[model samples]
Target: MRTDRTARTDRTAPVDRTVATAVAAAAAIACLGTLSACGPDNGGDQNAAPGKAASPAATSPAGGTGAGAPQPSAGAAKPSAAGSASAAGTRDIPAGAWIDPRSIPLDATYHWPAPAGAAKSVAGAPTFKLQELCHSKLSPDTADLGTGRAAAQSLAGAGGPDRWQAQQTLLYEGDPRPSSGVAQSAHAVFSDLREEVKACAKTAPGATVKVTGPENADYFAATVTVPQAGGNAVTLHEYLTAPDGTVNELAVWTTGKSGAQPRVPWVGPADADVAKAMDSALCTTLKDC
Candidate 1:
């Protein structure tokens, strides 16, 4: 159960205050709903999984290329039309259509340490949700994409609870044509996100959300910052890319300590860098390049 401090309002406040408060509360509820469906359980031991141990030098915050550093995918298999087509005559994103964990770009750019261990495969449903933008009202059907088949990987960070990253690829089935239901849903979700960001910026106080992408591009990056009491804030940086019937999302979370402002020194990858990384994954691993 995640809480957004910016949404809290006094019960005895004026009617206008109540109405304004509802916006953030609604967004928080929507986000929590989505998290319940898609987000990972951050409890228990994060590094308890027994497998190949991550090299300490590679993941160190000093940021150096080493054996444990994430490498780019080389000669990944491209999906075939026959293999991806389902019995319903609709395109299906294959289970293997995931970006190579080693290929994920993690460097000093984000000013954060790499995963403390090798990537762990995630099970069950897709784990990507576009929350915080208040798009729940735009299209109720499109609010959460966890209903689809998915492939995901999680990287657990060392040190504190606030450090971690996740990458997910969702597979939705629909007509293979350009005018397919899957394509339409993808377009509508992105469109609604842009519209909601603009509206949220106007209505929500002490919240900063920015989105950027090339015109007509199949990808976009969003950074959301919600201020809390005591001069602290939480920021989430997410990059989403939709190619055909597949949607890939990479997201990271960071929190500010003391009176530090999150925006002054960003804690995640640059919009352009992460955008290029997602595009590269799509072109190299999942679809035809």
Candidate 2:
């Protein structure tokens, strides 16, 4: 449903075409796949459930994003044991592998998908454009964030102490874009995201966006904090990539109690842990890592 546009790529002259094109594609994907949060519904019936349409304010009808320290694991995982994890390599991996909800680090018993009415709720509000990616200001009005084709977006929120995650994978099985191109695009997205975080500190006082890692070539991630009145806050961390035409993304959001703020700086997962989690989730649908 999303339409592609021909925009200038140079920032000084008009815009940065490379990042703009890439982000527009990604935003279109987000509207359909709900991988990254997007703009409005643009009139089409998205079949989202009717509710108190959520706003762009950190809080969502879906749930609160918490800001707190990570929960402790029982103990450190051994290297050899971690290395043997499935989907560890790029060769011989399966395609369209099923993603087991349990593999994500949340309490499965309380997990739920994204709100049905999510699309309709956030109408007209400018989505968080990766300004860093485009290296230019994007006119929310000119860019149609929704109205794109709907890819199957598998969203779920698990119950736990301030924890929830949304996961979506996109496969370009017959598309013209090559795997290498996809990988390159992923790198660009992450790089811009980091730049956005750096710039946000100055523009959005008190809020923070911290880029974490590539962890390895396949992953690039970050942590976000939006301070609210009464001491409460919304926090989010996400990992995203399109490894060889297959897009794999995971985002976790947590909400802290009134006055409870993030206690420590975020340093993403261990390389091994990231590898294991991505493999376990992707293996269900993909044959290759």
Candidate 3:
């Protein structure tokens, strides 16, 4: 996450504590349900895979993020047939409501859920970003940028536990800092970021987080949907900024789809407690980064 507070809403913005609190509650409930439903997929383990853990991508000497650009489409979406596209005021897109960050492999095939809302966006097109939404409830509103939750280490050593066998992860051997810490500012920053994300999700239909480009910069986002918004399939993006402030690695995900898709929000809102825990974890792990 950019240490820049300027990219976020002001503390004095129209905050509705009560409403936000309620949404936070819903978010917690949703997490429980989701955990129960997806527990199997979580592998119940977080150990690094056997062999050397993948190193975060290296930063370019030019100080530019080296993320590869999105592949271009053959041509503009063919104009809809006279009667195929719904008239204005429609709520969602046609059958494939999902959004594939236009960066799919040329030979890849993607599938998206049928759009359920109106034929078109009521307010505007979805803002597909690629921040870490793994730890947030309000969906893609917030990021998991090298904050919150220390990267776990194996007692045996790098990839010692094997991500398949242990719930703990392997930290970069070259990096000395533990994934967690005992700092207050980090915790405070995490709490603040979570709160802001929760508030933003209220109005946003859905959001996405992406690693800021390929290599450098504090962290960047895809304000508007573009072919460059990669990892739309899994709808998950992880940005790893080197301690030196350069984003060295980024991961992206989204439900595979040819065009836009639907956001399967958690059953309830994201849990407020998660924010507290995440804040503490992040603060504790990365005090100064």
Which wins on TM-score, candidate 1 or candidate 3?
A: 1
For 46-154, candidate 2 gives per-residue lDDT tens digits of: 3341111211111101111000001111232111111122331111112223244444444343343332211111112112323322233323442221111111233
For all predictions, the C-alpha RMSD in Å is: 26.9, 23.4, 29.0
In model 1, the worst 10-residue window by lDDT is: 59-68
Q: Summarize candidate 3's per-residue lDDT along 1-289 as a digit string, tens digits.
A: 6545654655534476767888999999999988986585664433332111222212101000011000011222221121134332221122221112122111123221111111121111111122233222322432222222112211111121111110111111112232232223223333333343334333333443332332333332221222323533233323222232111222223343325453432121122222222223222332223
Each candidate structure's count of clashing pairs: 1, 33, 51
Candidate 1 deviation (Cα RMSD) = 26.9
Alpha carbon lDDT at 273, candidate 1: 67
**After superposition, candidate 1 runs with Cα above 4 Å error:** 1-96, 100-106, 109-138, 141-146, 151-155, 158-179, 194-205, 229-231, 258-273, 283-285
- Candidate 2 off by > 4 Å: 1-98, 108-152, 158-179, 197-199, 214-217, 258-272, 279-289
Using lDDT, rank the candidates from best to worst: 1, 2, 3
Q: Write the per-residue lDDT of candidate 1 for residues 133-216, one digit (tens) a residue.
A: 232234466544333322233333342334434434333322224235545554554465455544554545566777655655
Q: Model 1 compared with the native: what TM-score?
A: 0.48
| Best model number under TM-score | 1
